[model samples]
Target: MTLTRRTLLLGLGAVTLSACADTAPVSSLATTGLPADLRPTPNAAYDAWVASFRSRAEGQGISQSTLNAAFRGTGYLPGVVRRDRNQTEFTRTLEDYLAITASDERISKGRAAFDRHRSTLNAVEARYGVPANIVTAIWGLESFYGERRGDVPVISATSTLAFDGRRGAFFERQLVEALRILQSGDVTPANMTGSWAGAMGHTQFIPTSYQTFAVDFTGDGRRDIWSDDPSDSLASTAAYLSRNGWQSGQSWGREAEDGALQPQPGGPRFAVTRNFRVIKTYNNSDSYAIGVGHLADRIAGGGPLRGSFPPDQFGLTKDDRIELQRRLTARGFDTGGADGVIGNNTRAAITAYQTNEGLAATGDPSPELLRRLGG
Candidate 1:
């Protein structure tokens, strides 16, 4: 999800593989009298990569001065590489995920923040169509309301990931976009800090996403999402959801009144609606969208789910369901959408896919299937 920029919110303790990791900030790079050509990379091999990249950047129309300013003192981040390589996948029931993402503490804080920013939230909603409570819920979830917007230097993180080469082409693209962000003068290198994967600011937008979706709601001439003030960040988040088809006045979802797990007449499944699909654009996990919905509903003075899910059923978390859908989709089996909430479409896709691949046609998605599918 962060790859699409949704994963940027992962790593708030129990939610890492589900999304952003907490990290430190990068140091300033504003030394006076510094010459760009004189900057040296930490490793000789990395230096060679930097040199090779310089030509590619130049071909992309990035000026040497801009490149120099961006890369000065830039080096590989071993920690970034280590974290990326060691990402762990774990399971948590829907209830368990909500316990952490929408805890009472978070809900209380969300209400307080929503009250404090009521006027701004109102104006943003008018312009962008995203409701106040939903925006505040994402705010609380993303960084505890700007308390932790990540600290890893953007350039260092991207450079390290690009140099490490596990997903070199992808990281290299990100690194270039990062350099472009620096060259545009949005923020100085000293100020361009974020997660190791280059997700920056209050809403944790990857550079490309920032370029496409960030807005200067404050009219301050800059889309500043990193400052102590969160107006731009909040507005930008609204913009993201709205542009992605957020329906005004429509709730994300509601729990079944009876907590029934029965299928739609014939088989076991719960078909998600259009709005539920919109929420998935944020994190692509049924649990994430549902968490945001439930948390926002709570912040709006709404009550808890009238029903509950059997935690041990399926032995998979919302994240796992999403991964299964992803694998199924990758193998050319369409599950309609990979929102992690299995429906008739998903079961049929699994059954057909299993049959084609010579596996049991049980129609059940499992860790074993995911392992075989190589997600």
Candidate 2:
């Protein structure tokens, strides 16, 4: 989910269909020279749509002052429309998914973050039944532990998507909820930021989700998930799991000697429990749940999986892929740290090396390519 925001829907057991193939950061106009499409642009149709939406909002209990304040500097963002229209679903293998979600970097960072916020996480776990590591893993997955909480303005994003009419009804509801949040004064219009699709805060809660699950763990009056301190967001996640039936003192799942729950054909098998299903309420993907479970295990000083995946579609084993990456990097092409997962960076590096060797640049690894790279 690196390219796109994690699909953290509020629906407990309902499936979320939206997917994005790529999701680069949308720069803030205040912080950087905004891209033309990302910046707010004038649109007569959008203004007219907002004019119509105002009445419906007021009908739904949005005060006039709240509406006026919410949409003050908000307008159509063409980038939001582009993102909504361009989403395409692509599934990564469970092995690759784990590699990205629970990579060495993420594991190290999760441990550090856990240590730094041990007291807060423990308190949150004590209050809610969800364990601290599970909460920490969700934070790591949602926004890279808050490092990439996005910079898009919530009002502008949801409003633009609502007016676009692809999934207008859903986003319109989100826009209304965002306005209600503004009215509650948890955050201000200027400070209300999120992803292009309007997922917000440290845990990437959509507006409705935030309204339902966000908490004020700091004991302030507001459920402030947008603050630098991650207490509220973390507690909110724990609360969501606890409410959704997270069984205290149970494993989310585990890598078993053998089981029927292998996500990939020749990958490591898992024997999951009821708590694993509870983790799915957050993102609703087996790989995501497993990633969180496994990462939580790792953050608690557990080792990697005991079982192994056979090989990738390219007929390359994890060791072979890692060797290929090392060979490529040795020859002046960087594969972004020899992770066995073949991501965009590895593919780009392969393409560059193939081009240099005057071979067809399919960017797909093969035994021949590995041999050429001195594997």
Q: What C-alpha lDDT, on a 0 to 100 scale, does residue 20 get in candidate 1?
A: 10
In candidate 1, residue 162 scores what lDDT? 74
Over 62-112, each residue of candidate 2 has an lDDT whose tens digit, in order, gives 998888767765667887788777766768898889888999999999999
Cα RMSDs, all models: 13.0, 5.9
Give me the candidate number with maximum TM-score: 2
Candidate 1 lDDT, tens digit per residue, 211-320? 88889998988888878888988898899888888888787756653434322232222334566777778777777777787799899999865544443367775568
Instruction: Give candidate 1 regions above 4 Å deviation.
Output: 1-3, 7-41, 258-272, 309-375
Listed per model in order, the count of residue pairs whose N, CA or C atoms clash below 3 Å is 9, 0
**Candidate 2's C-alpha lDDT?**
0.81
Q: Per-model C-alpha lDDT, please?
A: 0.70, 0.81
Steric clash pairs (candidate 2)? none
